[model samples]
Target: MGIIRKTFYTTVLTGASVFGYLGSTTTLISPLPQDDPFWRSRSFARYNVHHNACTQDICVKRIPLDKIRPELLQKEGDLVLEFCRGVWGGLGYKPQRAYLARKYQGPATASQLWTSEQLSKSTYERGTQITDHFEVVEKTPTDIVVRCGDTPRNPNPRDSDGLFVISAEVDKQRNEAVLALKSCFFNSGRKVEGIQGPTPGWMEEAHRWYTRLWMATGAWRVTR
Candidate 1:
């Protein structure tokens, strides 16, 4: 009887955990199937987007401009660069150190390479590698788009075809600016091969939550 009771509770808890996990991930929308011309052409055509887990697929987030005005939106370029420099390392996931490995002056091209190091958050672990092929695929006065992809040194296979598209613009009609981040990656075996296993569904939920926090914090940091 005791064993039966334990099994019942375990089953109940497992079901609850699964339900909670699914509820959290329901809103995560990958950009792969979207009709946006630029995303379709540039990201899809160029990368190995498999639409898997957090690191292996695209997830997007947006935040309102709030007090940020249109005039400030014109500085999107500087804001993005600053976010990469000052904000990315400390994003809510885990705190780490980062530094630029490349430089760019004007609009970047397909060959424009941007590399940076994300030092391990743990005092004992070695730093993780990060790189981006940056290009201003499109830019206008009030809006700009920057595309980023991972490079060879990145440790995770999921990052091999990684892409992050940052788009910023002011919407005068809505009285809010939009800061949208679209991210995707491909492949998945390397990081999980050794002792690690497949990414748990709960971690994806955490990724979605932390991603939103990261975007919100970035928006606040830039406009603050």
Candidate 2:
């Protein structure tokens, strides 16, 4: 039984190490206060009624705008859009997009499909489709809100249909731009039951890891 105990302890240590590493690069905000600016933004206003019923996750990192390339600030929306593209370009998101494409018969080239020129010119207009599952719902110079998941075209939609937001706002108080990634899920209008139940703990943890990695990669891309 000594060998069994050793193996058990080893497994626990390894898991803890992995979790610690993942947590190191992440900054998450849960149970966002109702008064948070995000809730008052135009993007959120579109879905304000559903806020209380939604399952939301937010991850944030601040970027010192004064330190980054100055040309990126030439245009009003340039910084936020570049940051959004960076998040989508993250290595960790590639596999997730691939899996979704294969499982849902979505476009095969959904990952990194946007050219630099195309992204630079994009205004993120409402109803614009960003990928097979992601569509623009609202946007401004600082924030872009997207609706993702099964649509009315799908004979059946999953409970995961929801909103994904990427926002970069200059905070005068901190003298930095706050880059945030948020995911919110309520009921899939296409699904009669709405969100069936709470997400599994393992799934939530995995999602947190993915979000952190993606956010970190995006920050690196913008700052580097």
**TM agreement with the true structure for every prediction:** 0.48, 0.72
Pairs with steric clashes in candidate 2: none
lDDT of 2 by residue, 84-139 (tens): 77776566566765665455544543432344344435556666654366777778
TM-score of 2: 0.72
Kindly report which residue pairs in candidate 1 clash with one another.
none
Poorest lDDT segment (10 consecutive residues) of candidate 1: 119-128
- For candidate 1, the lDDT comes to 0.43
CA deviation > 4 Å runs, candidate 2: 1-22, 40-52, 103-123, 151-159, 188-197
Question: lDDT of each prediction vs. the true structure?
Answer: 0.43, 0.66
User: Using TM-score as the measure, which candidate wins?
Assistant: 2
